[model samples]
Target: MGHRFELHKDVELAATPEQVWEAIATGPGIDSWFMGRSEIEPGEGGRTRLTMAGHVEEATITAWEPGKRFADRTEPGPDGTFTAMEYLIEGRDQGGAVLRLVQSGVLGDNWETEYEAMKVGWDMYLGTLAAYLAHFPGRTAAPVSAFRPGAGGPDAVWAAVTRAFGLAGPVAEGQSVRLAVDGLPPIEGVVDLAGLPTYVGVRTADGLYRFLYSGAERGDALVLGHHLFADDQDPARAERAWQEWVTALPIG
Candidate 1:
């Protein structure tokens, strides 16, 4: 099939190639930063499964080498096309590692919409990955999201989101921050993801915050998501707190 879309990104990780491999190759490791619950047999041709928010996704390991490289491709999507994904790891001569992601495939008839969404999603997930290594080193995360249509431009919507999260303002990737909302305890983390009025994120001691501006052409929408990294409890409380805060924001 003629591949119609591709997205590639490279991120510097404050980790070793082995540490990076742990998060990318193993199921439990991926669970720490990527999916809801993941199970992967890392040898070539092994099975890989990821369950997210009750939905399951499967893939086959196309390539694998411990502490080096890994790759997988999903089953054909609705468009009769499959997305081939790859992770290339290189240990820097100075120290640390560089992780690269290349996802390419056909995106069917709704290519533009799907492609854009995937780009944004990757930005959040990958940034979360780096941040996870920095703080919550060995914990897996569960996702919870809350979004609502808004009544204004991206700038205004983003402003409202910042105020709600107690963020001083827009931040740059890698900036350390501490959030102080009125009804909650202090939340602290680093800005692993940042893209102006489009997206921003902070990976905290126990989780991550991914804030977004969406559907502006139709009617703006503000989406706030949490990736909670804990083994004992459901993410319900965090989800409810965020949903209520968004509803009470002055943006819309």
Candidate 2:
């Protein structure tokens, strides 16, 4: 990767180094907190791919050290794009672990906006990773994201969302919630995560619902990724329910 741009995030988690490594290195573990579906071919130069709602991103494994580090280097893009990603695991001085991600690459002209978005995305996903380890360790995640694009500004969208999902206030970890929407089935789960202002996740007996916010000039949108039970509870139906429900929302 060229030394044009770089984005890095370091997180201290309450899990061990082995646990952190497993969460980042394994396919199913990544599914728990990342894109809807992911598969990793272990070892240096192995290929890893992620698919969520038909969108795909792939990269070649660049570094591999069990319980210590894992990295990837993506192919060059048509627009002179370059990427080198790394996940480093270290034991914390306290009784926990620290997981760090360093992503560096060369960018075209519109790099600033993209870089900021990447930062937020990394913070959100890594926060989810920490939450998954804390709440649902040793479990594989099956995820499906229901997209609702062009929903408008965050304030209006968030209000509609709270009213629709029976969320009375800002989301936080470990809060109990009850679903109150149609088209989709009933959801009852503790707030597995609530990285509010953008990310909120609910882990239920059937699966997980990870809500994501997209803030852009074109129009902000929302995506709800139902993980670990996309098939368990009628995949098509759940997505349809969400699409229908979101369509019904008052778009601002």
**How do all models score by TM-score?**
0.78, 0.86
Candidate 1 lands at a TM-score of: 0.78
Residue pairs in clash, model 1: 32-140
lDDT of 2 by residue, 1-252 (tens): 223787879998888898888889999788778867889999998999988768888999989999898999878888778788998999977778988889998876767766777887787787677777876766766555677888777878777766666667776677777875586667788777666567777777767677778787424778776665344566666667777776788755
Which of the numbered candidates is closest to the native, going by highest lDDT?
A: 2
Q: Residue 76, candidate 2: how far off, in angstroms?
A: 1.0
Q: Candidate 2 — what's its lDDT?
A: 0.77
Backbone clashes, each candidate? 1, 2
Error of 2 at 69 (Å): 0.7
Residues 1-252, model 1: lDDT tens digits: 334787999999988898899999987577666635689986999988876545888889999988888998888876587788899999999988999999987777657767887887777778778887877765667676776776478877877666655567556776777766545567787777787767788776677788777655535777666677756546677667667777777873
The segments of candidate 1 whose C-alpha lies over 4 angstroms from its true place after superposition are 1-3, 35-37, 149-153, 167-184, 188-192, 217-221, 229-234, 247-250
lDDT against the true structure, each candidate? 0.76, 0.77
Best candidate, TM-score: 2
